[model samples]
Target chain A: MITITLFEMKKIIKSIFFFVMLAFLCVFLIGYYVFVHHQTVPVEKLIVETESMIHMQEQQIQELKRTINNSEDGGNSQLQLDLTVSEQLLSKNQILLKAYQEEDWQAVLQQEIESNEPEVERMKAGNEYYTSTFPTLFTLESRLEYNKWLLSHNITPVLPIDFYSWYTVYDLDFGDPIAEEYIKKQSEKYSSTGVYFLHHTLNLLFTIFGALIFLFLFGDILTKEGLGKNGPIHFLHTQPLSRLKIFIGKLLAVLFLSLFVIVFISGFCLLIGSLFDGFGYFYYPVLIYGEDFSFTFQKMSTVIFQSGVLFIFVLLFSYALLFLFSILTKRTLTAVGLTIVVLYIGIQWGKDTILSSFSPYIPFHYFSITDIVTNTFAASVKNFAFSMSTGCIVLSISTIALLFLSYFLFHLQNKLLH
Target chain B: MIIHIQNVKKRYKKEWVLKGINIKVEQPNIIALVGPNGSGKTTLLNCMTNLLSFHEGTVELVGKKHTDPSLFKEVSFLQDNRILYGNLTGYDHLKFICNVQHLSTARITDVAERVGMSSYLKKRVRNYSLGMKQHLLLAMAIINQPKLLLLDEPLNGLDPTSAITMRNILLELYNEGTTILLSSHNLDEIDRLTNTVYFMKDGAILKESLLDLNMRRYTVSVTDGKKAKKILEEKQIDFTSINENQISFDETTIDLQTFIDYMNQNDIQIYDIDKQKIGAERRYQELFEGAK
Candidate 1:
């Protein structure tokens, strides 16, 4: 079995097609990295957005002043309080804009906390809640904590520590559109080689092309043995090994080969990231959302590790699907095609259906690795059960079930029964 | 018994490809399976090696069922080049086989040297010629020094020199106490290799031993061949066969020495005596004569 498996791996590694696909992946990654870098919004763009936001606030302040002047109550009316908060917010943005313009890292962190702390405290005190379109108290508080941590460590910020603009809530609605745009810009660079940026890079790659890449790599694992017929499979079959051993050898080959490709991609990403940008903070704060707008914070390292585990499971599950298809179809392209189509349809259909009550039991619902680790997928599907632990279990069970199904089918066609 | 295949039946869809093939090899010798196209020669070999599913009966090799993988420890099948991985070097293939058969790595170099493919052993099979592939396949088959060797068309793409090398290897293996059952269309080479023949036609086999049948056929061409025939007949030397102006027979009818003496005494000037072994081709034509 060891010999067979090693030979199988050698076959895949030696294939010209495999090498070509790998080269293509490298080119694609480089192209994507360059494209993303160009897409990162510059500081000047954020400054303009901030200035326009200040103007909008000024207009709102003028309207509030008029309402305060026309109020029947004395200056102690609700309009007076609204006027005060708006004026304060306007003055704070002016200070933040100046700090940002000067590139004064300390003042920027100080201004962010000074500006957002009052509103957050107000929400905590059961006063008028912070604007519904802004970050939740939990997110703002997490941001404050990340800022405090950075300030204490004397680390200059490469990307904003804003939890509202964190990986999970990257597109969260903000009261000021300019603020939303600014946060999106900060989060767009969340793809560094830093331990903090690992999940983003992984999510970016795996969520989009992980399955397809893996499928293309090993989609013909079984069929390339000439569909287990008169092809080179007979070479192994005529050996001293049993059919079960042959199947196992190929199965293990898929597993090991998948690992090899995954490691290669990761190493490539690491090399690219390390070369361009210094490794970022190891314990960078990553905000994880919970059901009902509740949330918590996990270290970026933990999130990345969890994503790594879940993504591995997802890849193995994909191999199992391809394995079964390769056996059933007995053709490389057909097997790859059917596996992709099946996975696509299964995930699409599973989202609104199984993602609810059956999310923990169904693996397809957990295809979004970053979302699963961050609970954003669960929050989106309204199923809090789509966590990393559940994904591991679900994917393992599904993969094992697929293995059994394929093995049973193989047994039926084996010469033993005949 | 080295190889025991009993009543093995295999069918493809609605047609039976192998109809109750029963072959037992008790002694170490090279056996040739000769048949026309689609006669189930390869299929029968597959059944005996358990490479294909046989619907009925059993196959045993080296005291174990053919289905047992360990049986290959003492058994090897030299199949078509389709079984060769194009991307792997010939050395890689040989080493892999040795590993599986629990043989040492030393066998690869040894076998490569013996098979005379040592020079190109490191080259990928994809770049190998047809004869080179046959060399590699033959090397892989014998790397384990298998007790029973099954070869299907081992000489399909070999030049004369390569074919001779293969025949010599097969003969050497047979002499070394390895039982060989091979199927091929090369009748002259088969005649040179072994006398045991299993003629397969329409999924059944007619096993024949050339030693039992008259292997040698001598054609005597002489001046006045008609008189020679008459004189030989009158001399009570029974003729195995008599053609126009030529007398051809085997030793079964009478001794060659006595017949030559009588012909010489009759003053018949013998011009030529063309000797030939009744190999597979002649027997194959006779077996499948007047039938497509």
Candidate 2:
């Protein structure tokens, strides 16, 4: 086993470095574009711009009041006012300001004072009437408070939040010192504004590219032993050892080195993210949905357990495929190439055949590693009486079958290829 | 018996690669399985080592069934191609095989030194030449001091020195009670080393000759070889000739003595009377020619 592992380690050394560097560069660029520069620049400028606009509106309202008091037409003319359209517009803005200060957008108390034109009067009356009548369920303040609640509770998002649009247009500033600090801390958690599900899907697609890179480089390690024109078949077979041992040793080495490549990429991604954005991630207040949808330790534990189980299953499935390929081809490069082609095709086929429909019933649907990020397919989809039980049964049976196939191919190589 | 093959027959489509071949070998002897290119030698060896499944036969080794995993501990088959991991140094290769073979580090060192590969043990096999690779393979072949060693054309690409070294190593192992079944095309090497030879032709053993003693023979060059042949025939003596001068006959019978006496009487002065040793090459040719 040590001999096999050592060989496998040496084979994957280059791929490990290659993947790690790739992951680092990818994450670094994403962090620099979205978090470090994009997030801070426009947000700060928008805050200042919103404050200036509010002050300018207030000054325009004061100037209109002076005109109304000084002009003879304004003093006695209740029906025909001397106020310009801009002044009336500015007066309407003051009403909006008073409504905002009251932490609501209801009807103004003095609608007749702002305008006597039946059209303007009716518009102001309707606006104020709806505010006083309709119940305010989803306010901006309540939304921010919900976000704070989510972070403290570690609630994952089940729905999208377009905060960038609302924040830009409404100028919903959290000027309260404590609230401001809370908002900044929460904003730092995510560092980007987009739909969670879409964001995750895109992340998975990018990560697929990483997997493809690994796939391309995978076969270089395996075929080097078998594909040489005049290779040392005699040396290996004549060593008074079982062929199975040799096959197993080689398998172990390849798997070990392959894992190292995966870890190197993961570590590099972390390192680049840290370098580019000072090691931070954004948090959002979110509503989670599942079997146990709650902001509790038990829910978090469920996520970890479910995700871990899915991860292991996916890893085993991939390893089994690679093992079968390695034994069948007896050449590392061909095995890797075939594995990639088959897997790439398999994923597409599976998506079309199984995933687009009731794919959760198919055991292979859950055998996807990308599901860890996307969170679409799970062990079971329907909440039937024995759905979970059926899913486990199917998964276990398929996994065992795959393992058997791997061992069978390995045994066949020993018997026939010798 | 260290290795035994009983009526083994292997077929590929309509052709019988090995036809009911029977081989029984004991310890402390170098047995060479010599044959032509497709003469069932490799197939028979593969069957004995359980690498190939014989259609009609049973193979036994050291009282254990060849199909049994326990027998693997006793038999070490040196395959034709030296298959080693590309990245593993020769030293690492030895260590890996030694661990599996249950031999000590000292034993590995000893085998390395015997094969004259101690200097190149630390280098990767990718860097080793064909000769060096052969040495490494030879080292592995004798690693476990196996009771039965199956070598298929072990000296195909070896240099003279390495060949001699390998021959001596096989002899040494034989002395240590290791029975070796070595296959080769070069009949002379087998003739020098092996006690028993299995001469195969057309998928069957044509002859199994136990070479115990060197038969005495003489090659005579006659001035009138055709006349000499007629005289020898009248005298009822056996002789084989080439051209008009050269004649060959075994000197085992007293008929040759009588022929020499008659020759003396007739004053037939023999130009040459060189002693002939029946070599493996001649025996190999005779096996085929006699079959025809």
Candidate 3:
């Protein structure tokens, strides 16, 4: 079994496809490094966007005043209310722009809290907890607490206090494309450091691209061994080893090599980032989603570590699934294609309402490794079952199931293909 | 018993490729399975080695069931070169066989030398020629010094010298008490290797070993063939006159010594006698007559 596993790994490592995947990772890292300079959105740009908003609000307030002075309209009271709201917004923008210009992040955060606190209070008073902009009290409070945390920690704001969420858009958009782009680019992901670069790559990699890299790399493991009577796999089959050992050997090979590739990417990113910049804080706070719309923060290093653990299992689950399909299809591309289709459908359907109650049971829900760690997908879809522990359990079970099924089919097929 | 395949049956899709095949070998001897294509020769071999599951009956090698993978420690199958990983070197293949069979790593070098593939043993199988691949397959098969060696077309892609080497290696293994079951289309090579031949047509084996009926054919060339032919014809002997100076007949008709004694007493000078072991070839011709 060890020999078979080692031989499989040697075959994979000797393959040009493995090197190609490494090159792609290097290119992503180098490309990020080359373009990271432009990724950071300066506070000056935010200040300018705020000033423009303030100027537009002032013009609206002036127009309201002229209309009030020119005519004694019957609906002047409503117009006056509009005028008051517009004036309040105008003053809020002025204060924010000034704090940004002075680089007083503390004052700016305080100002934002002071301004939004009233709206949150009014919504509570009127029982209007949801809005298009502020969908829930959780969103309002999450952003408010995010700012308070930053203020208490004395960490300057790189992104808005709501955290780097995919669903929230309350950051400094200023109704301008430039401001929106600026807001998206303000994360520490653009920073040149070991922690920052790995975090950034981790966030991007847990998606389909990472799955595909390993899938394509090891996709042909079984098929290349010769499912046919004349295949090289018969060489092993004709040996004294059992079929179960062969399956275990290939399984171990995929798992070990997959872990190697994942770690290699992470280490390579860190090497490039630290070599160029420096080793940044592993304790940098990353937001973690909680039940009941509650939330907490974890260290960046912890997040990455946790993501690695879960992603390893996720890759195992994928390989197991692919191996099962390989036995059925007996062709590399077709097996990979079938696995991707199945995984894709599982991810999509798991997100949908078909069996929403069982989302946590679905292994594909944890496809986004980071999302699972942070409970982002769970909180987004309101299914608290999709946590990291649940992800590990579900994927472990699914992998074992697929492995058993695959081995059964492979055993049955040894004679059929003959 | 080294090989005991009893009433084994195998089907390919809807066709019965092996129908109630039975063979039992209790001693260490080379056995050849010669047949036409699609005559269940390879299928029976596969069934015996458990490479292909039989529909019915039992196959045991060296007292262990074929299904027991440990039987492979005492049994080796020299299949087509497709069983070789093209990306791996011949040395890798030999080393793997040794590892799987729990043999010493020292055997790889020994087997490579014995097969006369030592020079190209370290080269990738993809870079090897057809004969080189055959050598690697042979080396891998014999690396464990198995008690029973099953070879299917082992001489498929070999040069004359390599074929001779393979034959010598098999003979050596036979001398070492290895029981060999060989299946091939080359009757001449089979004849050279073993006298116990099984001829198959369709999905059944021809019942007898043909050893009882397999007689040495004698081609006697005398200085004067006319007198020899006249004497043989006068005695109502069955013979073929190759030319005026030569005549050929099987031992079944008359013992070679008796025929030679008659020629010497009749003042006929026997120039040369070519004795041919045509057991397998003749049986093959008779069994698969008109087969291309």
Clashing pairs in 1: A194-A280
| Tens-digit lDDT string for candidate 2 (B147-252) | 8888888887888888899889988888888988888987778877774777888788865444432565677776677777888888677677766778777765
In terms of TM-score, how similar is model 2 to the real structure?
0.68
Displacement of residue B262 (Cα, Å) in model 2 is 12
After superposition, candidate 3 runs with Cα above 4 Å error: A41-189, A414-418, B212-214, B218-276, B290-292
Off by over 4 Å in 2: A1-146, A149-217, A220-255, A279-288, A291-309, A322-349, A352-358, A367-396, A413-418, B208-213, B219-273, B288-292
User: If ranked by DockQ, best first, what sequence of candidates would result?
Assistant: 1, 3, 2
Is candidate 1 or 2 superior in lDDT? 1
lDDT for each candidate structure:
0.78, 0.57, 0.80
Interface RMSD of each: 2.0, 4.9, 1.9
lDDT of candidate 3 over B16-46, digit per residue (tens): 8888988889989998888888898888877
Give per-residue CA lDDT, model 3, range A1-418, as digits (tens): 8887887777678676778878876887788766653564556667777888888898899898888888856447888899989988887778777888888889888886786687668766876534434235555666666667767777666533323322242222335666455445533335666777788888877766788778988899998876854687878878988989988999999889988887888898888878976766676666788875468878788999898889888898989989999888888999999999998888788768524566678888788888779877676676778789998999999999999999988988846664
Model 1 iRMSD vs. native: 2.0
Which tens-of-lDDT digit does each residue in A132-198 have in candidate 1? 4456555565566667666666655654434445333423467687777876665655445434334
- Number of the top-ranking candidate, with DockQ as the measure: 1
Residue B1 lDDT (model 3): 80
Candidate 3 lDDT score at position A76: 73
lDDT of 1 by residue, B94-185 (tens): 88887887789998899999989999999999999999999999999999988999999999999999999999999999999999999999
| DockQ pick, better of 2 and 3 | 3
